[model samples]
Target: MRRNHLIALATLGSAALLLGAWGFQYLGYAPCKMCLWQRWPHGAAVLFGVAAMAAPVAILTLAGALAAATTGAIGVYHTGVERGWWEGPSSCSSGDITGMSTDDLFNQIMAAPLVRCDEVAWQLLGLSMASWNALISFALVAIWLAAYRKSAP
Candidate 1:
């Protein structure tokens, strides 16, 4: 495919993912801290995609590729946390509070976010949303890379 088509596809990929995240939010599926963290890169990629549409520059494609890869990595990390393979941040996941006082524990509980990063609130075909995001973002990464190569003169 031509460079412009590739760039548009990559940009649309990020936009679609962003829209999907918002759609879930609108449906009352609130995202956790980690989930929200994964969004920034996609948002950036969408912006990069728009810029690439105008300039179709190699730098823009490279930047978009980086953004896609960033979100993809976050999605993988989030998936691991959700699967209990590793612990997530204390702000969004339950952590060891063995030495905390009773009041401290209570305060922590009270201050806990409505959405926990470790919980799989929704899934499809045994894959959580994070898993799907990672997979799609990987594809987007490939598309962006192709665009980058094509944009090269």
Candidate 2:
């Protein structure tokens, strides 16, 4: 595909991501801390996409690729945490409160988010949303990288 098409796709991806977040919120699915972490790179990708369209340079495309890859990597890590392959942060992950005082427990519970990073709140075709996000963002990274390579002089 052409460079312009790649840029357009990246822009569309950002819009899609934003829409999905909104949909989830509307559906009463509040994002956990880690879920919120995944939004930064998407924002960067969208900005890079605009830059790619305006300048169409290798550096901008590379930035876009990096942004997408960063988010994809985060998604992969989050997927691992969800699958219990590795541990997530205690703040987002569940822990024992057997010894804590009532006040402490209450404070912890109140501060804790509704969504747990280790829990698979939603899934599709046996894959969690993070896995799907990783796959899609990785593809977007490839597209951005390809656009950069094609633009090389």
Candidate 3:
């Protein structure tokens, strides 16, 4: 396939994933902070793909790859959080309240976000959406790499 087609495919892949996420959101799955963070790079990659098509620059493809990597990395982190491999950000993750006053505990409860980043909202074949995003975004990274190699002189 041509470099432009490869770039477009990679870009569209991100777009499709974003749309799917939105679809899930519309279905009443509110995205947590981490989930929202994972979407940003995909958005950037879609734009980078358009820029690559217009300029056909190897650097743009490289940037797209970086964008993909960023999202992929975040997905991995999110998956780890979901699996309890590690704690997520305090703003979204449930923290211990072992030594809080009644008022403090109440305040924490009131301030807590509706969506907890450490919990899996949905999963398929034993994998959460974040895991799937990581896998697919990594594939996009390879596509971006191929585009870069093809366009490079």
Which candidate tops lDDT?
3
**Which structure is stronger by TM-score: 2 or 3?**
3
Instruction: List the RMSD of every prediction in angstroms.
Output: 0.9, 1.9, 0.9
Evaluate model 2: give its lDDT: 0.85
Could you tell me how far off, in angstroms, the CA of residue 149 lies in candidate 1 after the best superposition? 0.8
Which ten-residue region of model 1 has the weakest summed lDDT? 49-58
Q: Write out the backbone clash pairs for model 2.
A: none
The lDDT values for all models are 0.95, 0.85, 0.96
A best-first ranking of the candidates according to their lDDT comes to 3, 1, 2
The superposed Cα distance between candidate 2 and the true structure at residue 118, in angstroms, equals: 1.1
Q: What clash count does candidate 3 reach? A: 0
Q: Write the per-residue lDDT of candidate 1 for residues 51-87, one digit (tens) a residue.
A: 9899757999999999999999999999999999999
| lDDT tens readout by residue for model 3, 22-139 | 9999999999999999999999999999999999779999999999999999999999999999988988998777889999989988999999999999999999999999999999
- TM-score, candidate 2, is 0.89
Off by over 4 Å in 2: 96-107
